[model samples]
Target: MSEQSTTDSIVSFVLENKLKTILYTWAAGITGSLAYEWSRPIPGSLKIIHSRVYAQAITLAALGSVAAVEMYQATHHPDKVKKVDKHGY
Candidate 1:
């Protein structure tokens, strides 16, 4: 297989796995949010660590809620799920 096809197949495999997608989403959201929060100055009473924890918790909660909703829709309303192309567009 060519390099492009290999890359595409790897991405396709990741997208096809719901658990992997959820874990990836959580990891990305948590790390991205933590980085953003850490870069900002700590507000009034909150410490830097507290702000980081808050960011991580909120990110995880939000992403978890979204994943739960998507899973629910997939299970109960399979027809409503959007289909993706081979490239995951």
Candidate 2:
């Protein structure tokens, strides 16, 4: 097979694995949020469970944002990189 077709096949494989893809996206957000919260100093008076819930909410929001970008990327190719770069820099 040609190089372009091989690359296309790999992308197709990832797109087809719906459940794994979703878990990965959400996991990324959860990990990122947890790390962010860990590095900051919070009041000790706050309940641990409440803090955990807040962290999870932050993670969910991040995951939603990522999912939206991925959905937009799927509908609009070639332009995806431009959109990411515009936001990144």
Candidate 3:
């Protein structure tokens, strides 16, 4: 209804879709890594597989960090997740 509520709902919808969110993040990272590799003069000097592996590592690290933070919040401050930041918190 309200502008803030509409924005919040859209963000909530995106966050709720775990597979879509993860895939989007992974694809962004992988594409970025591959794009950089393709532009390098010595593309295969470091090995093409290394770029893929590094991209996967970065994706896993990001996902793992978010999961850890979410688990911590669920265990230590579960109520906060349900409450939106109303006063610019």
Q: Which stretches of candidate 2 lie over 4 Å from their true place?
A: 5-10, 43-89
TM-scores of all models? 0.43, 0.43, 0.56
Candidate-wise lDDT, in order: 0.62, 0.56, 0.66
Clashes of each: 0, 0, 0
7-71 per-residue lDDT for model 1 (tens digits) = 44544454456566656665776577667766777763455466567656765775675566666
Write one digit per residue (lDDT tens) for candidate 3, span 1-89. 45556644544554456456667777887788877887877747574676778778877876775576556656765665765486822
Model 2 lDDT tens row, 25-83: 55665566566656667754344444567656755765575566556547766453333
Query: Number of the top candidate by TM-score?
Result: 3
Off by over 4 Å in 1: 1-46, 87-89
Highest lDDT against the true fold, candidate = 3
Q: Rank order by lDDT, top first? A: 3, 1, 2
lDDT of 3 at 88: 26
TM-score of 2: 0.43
